[model samples]
Target: MDYVSALLPPVVMAAFFIALVVTIVKSQGGANKAKEDAAVDAALSRAESARQSQP
Candidate 1:
């Protein structure tokens, strides 16, 4: 019972961590991929332009 109590927290944390990872993995590169890519590219372009304009 002592060992079970000690190990239970880690087991529960690991289970939730795995679930989080699985959710993130499943969300990648789906219908929103193009929109996300476009948004990132636009942000990068803006940053680059701003940097160039500074100096």
Candidate 2:
């Protein structure tokens, strides 16, 4: 019983961590891929333009 109690927290934490990783993995490069890419491109362009204007 003592060992089971000690191991239970780790087991539960591992399960939740696995679920989080799966969720993140599954969310990538789907319907939102284009939108996410466009957002990053826009941000990069903005930063590049700003840097060019600075000097």
Best by lDDT: 2
Top model by TM-score, which number? 1
Expressed as tens digits, the lDDT of each residue in 1-55 for candidate 2 is 9999999999999999999999999989999899999999999999999999996
lDDT of each: 0.97, 0.98
lDDT by residue for model 1 over 1-55, one digit each (tens)?
A: 9999999999999999999999999989999899999999999999999999995
TM-score of each candidate structure, all chains considered together: 0.90, 0.83
Clashing pairs in 2: none
Residue 8, model 2, lDDT: 98
Off by over 4 Å in 2: none
Q: Locate the minimum summed-lDDT window of 10 residues in model 2.
A: 46-55
